[model samples]
Target: EAGVVQSPRYKIIEKKQPVAFWCNPISGHNTLYWYLQNLGQGPELLIRYENEEAVDDSQLPKDRFSAERLKGVDSTLKIQPAELGDSAVYLCASSLGAGGETQYFGPGTRLLVL
Candidate 1:
C-alpha cells in the first residue's frame, strides 16, 4: 500500500508570501492529522480530521494558516503571509484511530523562508 504523499518535498519562499502544501493520506485510514516540526523539536499537532470533519484544529494558527479535507480523503494546508519563523517541516500523519494505533507519517514538506 502506498504511504502518505507530499509534494515538492522541499519549498523555498520569502517571508510574508503565501504558500500551500498538499497531503494524501493512506488509503482506508479514517483519521488524518497535520503537524508542524521546528528544527530539533518534535512534531506538534496543527489540525486533525476524522473523515471529512475537522475534529481537532485547536493548535492551528488561525490568523495565517488554513486547511481542508474536501473529500474526506486528501487534504491541503495553506499558509498566507507566512513569516520567517514559519519555515519548518509540515508533516502529515494517519492512523486507524482504534485504541491508540500508531500513526504513519509522510516524508514531510520542508519549507524555507527568506
Candidate 2:
C-alpha cells in the first residue's frame, strides 16, 4: 500500500517536520486503535491498545510514528520528522473491549506533507 494519499481535508505541513494527532474516546471504552486510510481504500490498522497497554502494533512504523493511550481515556499519535510519504488520513477508534464490539471512530486527521 502507498504510504500516503492526497485529500482536501488536510493538515498541511512541510516534509521532515513533526506532527501529532489526538483522540478522545467515549466514556467506558477501553480499547483504542489507530488506523491509516488512503484514498479509495479501507482503513488499515496501525496499532491497538487496551488500558494503556499496547496489544497490537505489528503494523505500526516505529521508526517514525508512535502512539500512546494515557489513562485509557485519550490517545495520541505522533510522527517525528514526518516524510512526504506519511501524508494520509489517520483514524482513531475505540470500543468497549477488543472483540466484536462496535467501534466508535473520530473524524479522521488528514495529513498532507509538502
Candidate 3:
C-alpha cells in the first residue's frame, strides 16, 4: 500500500508571504495529519482530523496557520504572512483510525523563508 502524497516537496519564499501545501492520503484512511518539524527536533502535531472534523489542533497557530480536510481524504495547510521562524518541514501523515495508530508519512514539504 502506498503512503500519503504531498505536493511541491520544497518551497522557498520571503517573510510575510503566503504559502500553501497539499496532501492526498492513502485510500481508506479516515484520518489525515499535518505536523511541523524544526531542525534537530522531533515532529510536532499541528492539526489532525478524522473524517472532516479536527480532533486535535492545540498546537496549530491559528493566527497564521490553518488546515482543513473538507472531504476527509485530502487536506491542505496554509500559512498567511509566513514568518521566518516558520521555516521547517511540513509533514503529512495518515492512519486508518485516530489515536495511537501507526501513521504513514510523506516526504514532507520543506519550506525556507528568506
Candidate 4:
C-alpha cells in the first residue's frame, strides 16, 4: 500500500498571499495529523483528525488557517493571507488509530513567505 501523498513539495509566496497544502494519508489509517515545524524545532501538532472528525486543533491558528478531512480519506490545509512567520514545513502523518501507535509521515510541504 502507499505511505502518504502530498503535493507541491515546495512553495514560495509573498506575505499576505494565500497558500494551501494537500495530503492523502495511508490507506486503512484511521487517525491523521497535521503538524508545523519551524527551523530547528520539533514538529508541533496543529490539528489531529480521527477519521473525518477533527479531534484536536487547539494549536491551529483559526483566523488564517483552516483544514478539512473529507470522507475520512484525504485532507487539505489552507493558510490565507499568510505571514512571514508562517514560513515552515507542513507535515502530514497518520496512524492506525488513536492508540499512540507509530505514525507514518509524508514528505512535508515546505512554505516560504517573504
TM-scores of all models?
0.97, 0.89, 0.96, 0.97
Compare candidates 1 and 4 on lDDT and give the better one.
4
Q: Report the poorest 10 consecutive residues by lDDT, candidate 3.
A: 95-104
Best candidate (score: lDDT): 4
Question: Whose lDDT is higher: candidate 3's or candidate 4's?
Answer: 4
- Model 3, span 1-114: residue lDDT tens: 777899889999999999999999999999888999999999999998988999999999999999988888899999998999999999999999976889999999999999
Q: On residues 31-88, what C-alpha lDDT tens digit does candidate 1 reach at each position? A: 9999999999999999999998999899999999999999999899999999999999
Residues 1-114 of candidate 2 have per-residue lDDT tens digits of: 111211223588999899888887777778888899987899999999898999999999999999888787788888998999888899888888976798877778899999
lDDT values, one for every candidate: 0.93, 0.83, 0.93, 0.95
lDDT of 4 by residue, 45-93 (tens): 9999999999999999999999999899999999998999999999999
Better of 2 and 3 by lDDT: 3
- The Cα RMSD in angstroms, rounded to one decimal, for candidate 3 relative to the true structure is 0.9
- Candidate 4's displacement at residue 78, Å, is 0.3
